[model samples]
Target: MEKRYRLRKNLEFRKVYNNGKNFWNRNLVLYIRKNDLEETRLGLTITKKVGNAVVRNKIRRRLKEIYRLNLYRVKDGYDLIIIPKKNVVDISYKELESALIHILKISGMLKG
Candidate 1:
């Protein structure tokens, strides 16, 4: 809910999207790579095809909610980008959250 925390900006999102190597686990897809900073950086990308600006903004909000709730679980020291697919527009919050955790597990960002 704050710019101070959000990974806002097209260029930052684009850099991760284009250059970061991605790995996936279920509905959750991740682009993880090194970051120059001491802390982890996060970005979310939703295209116009996901819907108009309203739909896109909603999706972004939903993603940020997931990230915020799960921030404690996600590891630090990586630049991460999340992209939601068209089918995700219809999914429930539970499923979206599951996908996020699923991929994080796959990436080994979460260890138990």
Candidate 2:
């Protein structure tokens, strides 16, 4: 995703973690906090426990692509952090996308 649409700073992630409302599925956890900006930003966290660098990067790439594809469907003005669970390593792209969309709907972040 573009740099402008990504949450890159540690402080930014921490703020969202501390203040955001969260939603999750078996595969992913989403932390969402409203932001003052007109655009939404995204962050992804995949801990070492999830896998090696290659594996974690793969998941990150997939999640970013999914978010990019569905960007138009999401509401703006929020900071979104997605944390993938261990089980996510085995899922296909389609399943991951659906899981994310499910959590987004549950969080009421998806625009109609």
Candidate 3:
């Protein structure tokens, strides 16, 4: 993902958590807030409770790739944060993508 499309600051994440509307499924939680920008940005959160550093990084990379591939299908002008649950480590990549897409669709962030 490009730098402009990634949420990197602590403040950014907090703003989304505090102000954004939330959506979730069995595997992931999604928080979304409008940014008034032309593109959507994303952040991913995977706590140590989920796994060790290697596992966390693997999940992060997978999430990023999923988001990157689906970027075009998502609506613009929103800041999105995705938090994975502990059981996420046990699921396959296709399941992870489906869970993310489920929340996005229900949240009205998925653009056809």
Top candidate, metric TM-score: 2
- Residue 2, candidate 2: alpha-carbon lDDT: 78
In model 3, where is the ten-residue run with the lowest total lDDT?
96-105
Which candidate leads in lDDT?
2
Reference-based lDDT, each prediction: 0.78, 0.96, 0.94
Question: What is the per-residue lDDT of model 3 for residues 1-112, given as tens digits with 9 covering 90 to 100?
Answer: 7899989999999999999899888999999999989999999988999999999999999999999999999999999999999999999999999998888999999886
Please estimate how well model 1 matches the true structure, expressed as its whole-model Cα lDDT. 0.78
Off by over 4 Å in 2: none
Error of 2 at 62 (Å): 0.3
Please give the clash total of every predicted structure, in order.
Answer: 0, 0, 0
RMSD for each model, in Å, please?
Answer: 2.0, 0.6, 0.7
Order of candidates by lDDT, top first?
2, 3, 1
Per-residue lDDT for 15-86 in model 2, tens only? 999999998889999999999999999999999999999999999999999999999999999999999999
Q: How good is model 1 by TM-score?
A: 0.83
lDDT of 1 by residue, 1-112 (tens): 4564457788777777788789875455689776676567788877777788988888788888988888778777777888887888888888988888888887787746
Between candidates 1 and 3, the lDDT winner? 3
CA shift of 81, model 1, Å: 0.7
